[model samples]
Target chain A: MIKYRQELSFKEALTVILYTLLFNTVIAIVLTYFLKPFWENFVFSQCIGILICLCMLMIFRFITTENPLLWLLTILSGLLVGSAGGFILGAFLTEKNPLVYIRQYHEFIRIMSLGLIFGTIITYFFLSRVRISQAEDRIQEEKIKRLTSEKKTVESHLKFLQAQIEPHFLFNTLSNILGLLDTDLTKAKLMLTDFTHYLRLSLAKTRESTTTLSQEIDMIKAYIEIFKARMGERLKYKFEIQDHIGELPFPPMIIQPLVENAIKHGIEPKVEGGEIIISAKKDQDFLRICITDTGLGFIEQNNNGIGLTNIRERLNSLYDDKANFEVMENVPCGTTVKIEVPIVTD
Target chain B: MSQIKAIIADDEKELRTYLKAQLADVWNDLIICGEAKNGPEALNLVDTYQPDIAFLDIRMPGFSGMEVAEKVADRCRIVFVTAHDQYAIKAFENEAVDYILKPVTRDRLKITVTRLKEQIEVSSVPPSDLPAIIERLMAELKANQKTDYLQWIRVSSRDGIRLIPTDEISYFKASDKYTLVVTGDGESLIKKPIKELYRELNPDVFWQIHRGTLVNVNFIDKVSRSLSGRLVLKLKSPPETLTVSRTYKHLFKQM
Candidate 1:
């Protein structure tokens, strides 16, 4: 019943039948040389053979079988019916008994059997190939659908992480300016201008995902400059950078968060205040950066913050498994935070 | 004009000093009775000094600004100092609960100061509305503060398990099955894979400049483009320059 349904349209089927007729006609002409008696009637006998084959093909449309035994049975039955039709048609055209005509043209019968066997096997091979390809297409579509949904989930999670960063630094600077507004308006104005420049740089940095090392250092300097104006004698920082490392690309906000952490945990707790030393160096294949502070050493109780986790997650996403971050105690009494990223030249 | 005693409560020392200065400028007769760096300290100062006005930062270390406001509701007129934008502030404006944004602009502070003067001169704060206003602001503040991110990394060392801060890492290199955790003091080997560590590290600090290397971009000092169109990166680290391959060269073109 399945095979009875039209797989090809009327036009397509016609074209296939025409090509089959042409192919058989050429095969019939080539066989005439081997059979001397049928040479004069070769075209006529070949037409009869082709006509019988077409009839057998039409009958195949009514049957469908996946089992190999049933497929073999179908092929045998088609060959029997086609050869028998050829014998009867040949006898009528030659005006002789069907048995005599078959005996006289027995070689032609052999050629018809060979053609039927090859045609049946070739059709089955093509049909199975189509079925396999169709199944593969379904699987591919399902995989794409799953991947699209997964991508959406990851995108939303990323957006949530991005939304958490508030402008707390801006407000803090503003509060500092307010204090200076009464005691010294001139210093307050200067602080305000510095704050504005910092704000502009921070905003611009946020717009991009990556920035050059020099730009980040400048941003850090601007940040430290604001802190100096506010803290005055309380904060001291030193930057020891090796030659020609600024042009390398880096992510923004990394240095600022570390600096803030050092100030908040490492230095602020000590009444006497402390200094921060930031340095960078190259060690074989890595670019090493460290932030050292002269304040209270590592505290077990206050060990975590958002900035550190964010750095970890970002490194994982950007570098896969190539970056490292570490924190340790500085000599004597302070905290030192170090980071090592692969030396990427671009 | 009668002097009005006030207390400024904020976690940041700089902020406390700044707010006091701003208050003096806006209301010359206002006298700063005390200052507290945390919410609990603010409450204790209020109890001890019994100031007429309290400027409470919405967020603080001990009992948050809202909790302190609730406790001191009966004794003083409250002015909330907040850093959040929009929704909560709309409620403050609607209910006539005086609030000021950070960096207290002169113009905005002037308005709040004038309103407070009129309210104190007219009568004490109506006790009935104080609790409801504090409750609404408290809920909003709680909602706003829920956003958080990770901040620490636990690294194993010969000195036992050390909780290393993420920012302390200089660079990470491949070491067989593990990654080398290079710090200022020394290096430790962590079992975490390079790709996995990269995902966890902050992208801003660590950059993968090569297939096997992650350079701390903070230490990068210069980039040199040779005549043959190849790029090399120099870092603040000891005399070393990294070769930038064709794939990563785009990072320096924009600079």
Candidate 2:
């Protein structure tokens, strides 16, 4: 029906008008047959011709998008063919009076033209509308498709980030373990053991679009071990969260850069690695995350570190402005960065 | 038992270096043969190192992980490192092998290495499936790998039948007996059915909306209803509209 609406033709429209006209003409004759013979005069015959003309006019509205050349041919054909039909029909009905046959013959020709001209004009009007409607539909469809594709890309990009970040994170941690390999083999071996478990959990969750907060935090804790191994006695960090938000859904790799930020801006800058606090709290309608670091704050000159910017963009894109991120000087001297976003609910 | 030699192939410089660095820590039994930046580099590394295992990245320049693995088909086992998609992952899984998703984890690497060791220990996975897996992976690359042009198309004008590149097409519409292939500059009258075109053209590029028409999926905007349950596509640029068929209702799901 949509295709038909978009591509209706004049030939098809004319054919429908012609058919309707003939159909109405025949029905008028049948009614004339049933009417009282005393009242049936030349006026009644003219009335039948007008009835056929009206039917053709109405049909023109239905098929407005017909081909001009094809429609012209169809309308001309309808006129010639219909006139002949009326002449034949007239010959049988008005055989006794030549005058009656001639008069009715002229009347039938006029009725056919009425059906043709009006049908063509009205059909062309409706057809232009069809074309307009189809164009509008196409525009709307393109917008939706673009949005969907963007969503997929955002989703895929999120996955890719996780994919890119996870191994990179793991490998870095492994390198930290490697640093301890010669110095402390037993501790390095234990790090490897815990790291492997963390990786299994991470890889297991890779296919999913979202995971629970508890699951994400556990993965984070596993990751922090490698950092702990790297920082040794210098680093300090803690995990804080409310119990109810454990099942809230967040995208994979939500905590990825925050931890890195804690390490980069918070722990790494200090001679004795400063304490890094990673907390996830539940707001009335959102999950509040604070990756506060007790070290040098973000270098104002170096505003676009890949980790902080990437996290901010992903959060903005995912949660729009619903996400809250704050980077401010800590109570004493270090930087405290806070991030809050809507928790995904089960 | 002779030690199993291994090499890491990845596009990321940091990843390959980091993997190589991390591999040094554990797996004392395995030899750290070499590393390559891209697929071709890795393929060359394979010739030089001839390692027992190749860790390949599915997406890479010159050759994919799957392609380089083909060169070392019989000699070594493959552990694909992919971002994770059903079309690509199936190739490795079907062959009873494994893939490590990026960012590589120490634990996952251990698991994969453990799987690799087991495969070598038993000689369980068939070497013959390598060719088939390679072919399947290549086909997947063809499927998921998007193109700007149509695959097999034939266009007609006063000159004769010329195959118009899919990208050159602006739009297509079914006229009485023929389908008109409209372009930015002109149109082509071709005697081709939309169904045949749908099968031959890349579905990733071209989409079927109406019985009479197959539109470039990229050209479509959104599928919306006019009156009742009718559906149509809002296109980009020259900005035309198209209608969808009842038969293909499930296609525009989000719309």
Model no. 2, DockQ:
0.03
**Candidate 2 per-residue C-alpha lDDT over B1-255 given as tens digits, one digit per residue, 9 for 90 to 100:** 687788887654445655665566557678878877666788888788878788887655556677787677776777787654557766556656578866566887788777777778887333667767677667766777544334334554343333344654656778888887865445768887776667667676677766777777766655566433557676764467676788877888865
The docking category that best describes candidate 2 is incorrect
Residue A25 accuracy (lDDT) in model 2: 50
Please, what is the whole-model Cα lDDT of each candidate in the order they appear? Answer: 0.68, 0.63
Q: Model 2, A203-275: lDDT tens per residue?
A: 7776686788888888888877766765566678788887777778887776755676667545554544578
Q: Point out where model 2 deviates above 4 Å.
A: A1-92, A99-346, B1-4, B118-255
Largest TM-score belongs to which candidate?
1
**With candidate 2 superimposed using the best TM-score fit, by how many Å does residue A149's alpha carbon deviate from the native?**
14
Local accuracy of candidate 1 as per-residue lDDT tens digits, A176-287: 7776776678888988887777667767876677887778777677777787775556679999988888877777667767887787667654545679998987788777
* Cα distance off (Å), candidate 1, residue B117: 3.9
